[model samples]
Target: MPRSFDEILDQAAVPDTVTDADLDALKQEIVRDVTATLMFGARPAPEGRYPTTLDRAEAALTALCAELIHSTDAAEHLARIADLPIDADGALHFGCLLNLAQEPDGALWWWQFAAGAGNATAAYCLYLYHLFHGELRDADHWAHEALSLDTDIHLTSPAPCRRRKLDSPPEVLREAIERLKVDEVAGAQFHHPDHRLADQIEELADAC
Candidate 1:
């Protein structure tokens, strides 16, 4: 039988003994594979077509980087990540920045970059960021953008799991920001609750 998604990810995950060179090589490989998947849609392999397994493997590698990356290497690592194409809206690049980089501001910049490139998850995170900082107007706009991407989104889960709103607003926002809490970006995903707050907030902004 074919290996399961979790199995593949476990097998492909970066080892704790991974060296700088090994990590660099793995990142390059992930960039290539993800780029090809984005470009070609689906490439035929002897085993099968592209699936969630590949995506999970990529995330596992990125999460591992969050664990093994050194503070001194963060700048160089970010520079390499920035070079990856944004066709996937720099998902992998942003993930590494958000989950590994020690500088919160720098990670936020990468989130803005990804959101600008139309990454819904990044946009939602930006929404939460702005909301937490009391920039409700900007948060409203980002929330709208996120919903526009996934109309029936449920903004609760820490990852792309089933639809539910178990997390409270504070918890949701906290989890989003806490993604940078070192070695923990494996399954981070975001969604937005159904609401017309964005339009109302925009109108309020206009009047101000």
Candidate 2:
């Protein structure tokens, strides 16, 4: 039997012992996993067949990256992902890197591109951007857009299961900024009843 989603997530969260070789191996694994899943979905592309399994696999890898990659090699991870093709909504991978890089402008650009292509992660990133920058109207738009596209609500909740440590201060700082935006939007929105209980989220954003 296949491992459950929670099991896969737990496995992905295991911190790799920091080594250049370890980083390289993990990077290769990520790229391979991402590419394999994308190609699997593309197998019936000309006929427009929706490969739900492949899509879920892709999302799982993305969430894994979001949960795992941290300060020690965050820049390297970002650089690697930035080199990948942004053909699909997978550009969220690149935007996540930009967020890690603390390049809000760059992150916003990629996020918008992915959002236009219907990536909920990208939409959520863009929403957070506007929220932190105090662009309320645009923030609301992107927040709603994110919600509209994110039918599964994968990253919306600030669960402890989603928390991970960064190996560097800069990376942690950047992550904090991004988290702040997430909470800001979450707080202002009345649609989510759970938003009120997101105290840590509010605190994290406030610190930024």
Give the TM-scores of the predictions, in the order they appear: 0.33, 0.39
For model 2, the stretches where C-alpha displacement exceeds 4 angstroms are 1-84, 159-208
Clashing pairs in 1: 155-191
Error of 2 at 141 (Å): 0.6
Q: C-alpha displacement of 204 in model 2, angstroms?
A: 22
Model 1 lDDT at residue 103 = 33
Off by over 4 Å in 1: 1-83, 87-96, 99-102, 152-208
- lDDT (tens digit, per residue) of candidate 1 on 93-155: 344333332333544555666667766766666665554343445766877897776665324
In model 1, how many backbone clashes occur? 1
Candidate 2, residues 1-208, lDDT tens digits: the string is 9999999998889696699998999897566445544533322222146533333333343343354233244343334433444432435554554444444555566567678877776776665565444344686688789788876533633322323334442544454434432323323311111121122222323222
What is the TM-score of candidate 2?
A: 0.39
Residue 25 CA displacement from its true place in model 1, Å = 52
Residue 69, candidate 1: alpha-carbon lDDT = 28
Best by TM-score: 2
